[model samples]
Target: MKYIFATFLLLNTFHLFGQESAPINHELSFQFDNDLLFFDAGDRYYTNGLFFTYRQKIKEDRSWSNLFGFQSLHKSIFHVAFVSKIFNPYNLKGEKAEEIDRPYAGELYVDGLYTSYWGQNRLAVGVDLGWLGTKTRSDDIQTNLHTTFGWVRPRGWRDYQIHDTPIAHLYTGLSREIVSIGPLSLISDVDVRVGTINTNAAAAITMRLGRSQPLDASVLTHARTGERIANDRKCKELFFVTKTQLMHVFYDATIEGNIIGEPSPFVKSAEPWVWMQSVGVMLSMKTFDLQALWSFLGREVVGGRPHKYGTLVIAKRF
Candidate 1:
C-alpha cells in the first residue's frame, strides 16, 4: 500500500510540476453497494463493496498542451486516474456461506483517457489496466477482518489458489445532447469495452429537468471519463436527472474465470444480458457536487435474482 501511494503521489507531482500553468481539476469519490437495500437476509452475488476513485484532468489549451502536442492531435483534454476497490462474494458471510464458492477479491485499476468536444457532443477513448483478485496474503487477511467487523462469521481458512489475474481493455464512448425543450434536455451516451478478458457494451439516455441556465451538459452523461469541470463561474444548479441503461456482455472473465482455462467452483454458465434503471438527482455548486441514485439491476444469470442498490457521490473540485 505504501508503494502504491508513493507511485500515485509521484505521478501527481510530475503532472502538477509539468503542467503548472494548466488548469487542472481533481475529484475524489466513493461508491458503496450492499444487498440490504433489496431486503435480502444474506449477502450474495454483488455483495458489499467499496470503490474509491481519484481523477485528475488537465485542460488542453494550457501551456502544457504544447508539451503533449494535444492541440496538434485535436484533443481537448487529458485525464489520468486510479481506482481501488475491495469486494466480497457470498462465501465471506454467514454460516451457510459454503454453498456459494466465490472468493473475496480486490481490484486495482489505472486508466488514462483523451477527450474532445464538438459543439454539444463529446468523445472519449481510453485504455485501462486492471489487476483483479488477491495480490497477497494480506489481502485475504484484510478481507477476513472486514467481514468480521461487518458481523459476518469468519470461515477459518479456505483455498483461494484459483484467483488472481490481470486485465487489459480499451474503451471508447460518446455523449451527445439530443434535444432541449424549455428547461428539460435529453442526452444520450454509449460506451463499448473490449479486451482479452471481457467485452461489454452499454447505452443510456437521460432526461434533465431543472433551471436551464445553470445546467451543464456534461453532468447529464454517465461516462466518468467524459466528465469535465464546468468553466462557467455561475455553477450553482439543481437538476432532477433520470437515466435508464442496458448492457450486454459477451464475456465476463471475473465471473466465469479466465477465458482459456477450466472453470472454477464459482463459475456459472455465462449470461450475456443485463439491464439497469436508475433515477438520480444532482446538485452542483461552484465548489462541490452531490448526486444520489437508486438503481435496479436485472439478473446476470439464468437462475439469479434481480437486485437493487443505491449510490451516493460527493466530490470537491479544486
Candidate 2:
C-alpha cells in the first residue's frame, strides 16, 4: 500500500508535463464487487470479484492500426485488467459434495479490450485468457485476506474447489443512446461472450439524469476520449443513473466446470435467465472521476438465493 502511495505521488509530479494534447489518456482503476458493502451475509454464489485495470489510448496509425482505420472513429483505447472471481456454495461449512447448491470455484484471468467510438455509440471487443479452478489460488487469497481482517475463515473452499484447468473467452459489446432530453437520456446496450470459461448474452437499458458529456467521449459511459487534453474541457459533471438488465446463459464453467479435461467432482445447472437492477451516480473533477453503483440480481443457479453487490470506481486522468 505504501508503495502504491509513493507511485501516486511520483505520477502527480508529472501533472504539468502531462498538459498537452498527446492524443492519449491513462486511467488506473480498481473495482471490487462484494455483497458485504450492503451489510448482507456476503458469502455464497457470485461471492466476490476483484479487478485491477489500466487503460490508455492507442495510436491511430501503425502498420497494425491500419486494419482498424481508427482515424475514422471518434476515439480508440486499449485497456487491460487482472480479474479474480470467486464462487461459493450455500453452505461453506458442509463437507464437499454435489449436494451443495453450487460448486466451489475460482477464476484468475487477464483480459484485454479494444474499443472504438462514434457519436452516441461505441463498439468493444475483448479476450480473457487464464486459469480456472484450484490454479486460480482463490482459497489462498481469500483465507489470507480473511485472517488478516478477522473475518470468517473460508474453510470449505479448499476441500470443495474444482480441479485446475485453462480458460479462454471472447466477447464483444455495442451500446447506443437512442433518446436525449436535456439532462435526461436513455441508452441501450447488448453484449455477448463465448468460450471455455463462460457463455452468455445480455441486453440492458439505462436512463440517466443530471450533467454529462456526450456519449461519444464521456467518461461516465467509459467512452473516454484520447483526442483532447482533458483539462481543456474544464467541465465538472455529476449524474445519476438507473439501469435494468436481462441475461441468458448458455454455459458457465464457474458452476458447471470445464466441459473437458479431468472433470470436476461436482457441477450444477446454470439458470437459463437472470435479471439485474442497478442504481448509480458519477462525479467528475478535472483530476479524477468517481462512480458508485449498487446492483441486485436474481439467482444465477436453480434454487440459489438472490444476490447483490456494490461497485466503487475512482479513475485518474493523465
Candidate 3:
C-alpha cells in the first residue's frame, strides 16, 4: 500500500503540474477492479469487477429526450456498458456452505446511461439489464484468474452460489459544484436506484485539487474527455481526488438472493446503511485518459467487516 501510494505521489510530483470543455464526439473506456491490488486486503465480498463502456455526444433527435431531461441540457452524452461483479464470503476455507460468512454471488449485466451537463450541474439516468447467479460465469472467471495468478482457488462455489435470475434496475443521480477556487473544488451529489438487483439512495461529496476545469467541462466528473475544446487547443489534466458516499440500502439481491425467486442455500440480511470512500488521481492527455483509485466499502452484511479494492481505468476520445 505504501509503495503504491508513493508511486502515485511520485507520478503526480513529477508534473508538479499539468493541465477541458468541447464535448468529445465519442469515447471508449475499460475499467477493472480487484481487492488484490490493495496489499494485504482479504479476498471477500465485492471482490472483483470488469467494465467496458462506449459513449457518444447525443446528436439524434429523440422525442423522449425532453421527457427524460436529456433535451434540457447544454450538452449530453449517451453511453452503454457491459459490466460484471463478483462477490465471495469472507472465508473461502469453509468446509461447508453454512460456514461461509457471506453469500457467493456474481452479476453480469449491460447498462446504458444518459448524462446531461448544464451550468454547474450534471444529471444522469440509466437502466441495467442482465442476469444474476451462476449464469454470470463469475466462478469460472475467478477460478481461472486465481489459477493464472497462482493464488488460492475459491472453494465450494457449486455448493453455495446464488441461484440464477433475470435482473432489471433503474437509477438516476444529480451532481452540482458546491464551491470552486482555482484548482480546488467541492461537489455534492444525490443518487437513487430502484430495481430487481438493488434498491437504494445515496449522497456523496467529492473534493479535487490540482489542474481543474468547470464542472460541466471536467474529466474527473466524467462530463467531458478526449480532445475537448479548451482555449481552442489541446487540453490536459492531472488531479488528485477524494470522495465519500453514504447509501441507504433497501434491498441488495446479491446478498439476500432473488426476492422474487427461490432462495439460495445461504443468504444474509444486508446492512441498512453503508459507507464508501474513494481516493485517487486522474490524468488526461490528448486522446487518452487514465485513472487509478482505491475504494473502501463498509460492510454490506450484518456481521461482515469492511473491504478495500482498487480500480484502474483507461479511456480514449475521438
Please give the RMSD to the true structure for each candidate, in Å: 6.6, 2.7, 5.7
The digit string of per-residue lDDT tens for model 2 on 28-139 reads: 7667788776776547677788788898776656454333564556767788999989888866666646547888889889999988776678788999998988877888
TM-score of predicted structure 2: 0.89
State the local distance difference test value for candidate 1.
Answer: 0.58
The lDDT for every candidate, in the order shown, is 0.58, 0.77, 0.80
TM-score-based ranking: 2, 3, 1
Best by TM-score: 2
- CA error at residue 61 for candidate 2, angstroms: 2.9
- Estimate, for each residue in 1-318, the C-alpha lDDT of model 1 and write its tens digit: 355434434443331233324443565544455555555536555555555555545454466533434333422555566655543444544334344444444566777776655556667788988776656343565556656667554342244322667768899988777887887988798999998556999999878888532112243432232234344455555788888888998876655666544444455444688888888787665445567777788876555567666666655444
Query: Weakest 10 consecutive residues, lDDT, candidate 2?
Result: 62-71
TM-score (C-alpha, index-matched) for candidate 1:
0.72
User: Which candidate do you rate higher for lDDT, 1 or 2?
Assistant: 2
| Model 2 ranges off by over 4 Å | 1-24, 63-72, 96-99, 225-227, 230-235
Report the Cα lDDT for residue 157, model 1: 25
- Candidate 1, residue 253: the lDDT equals 63
Model 3 steric clash pairs: 19-236, 19-237
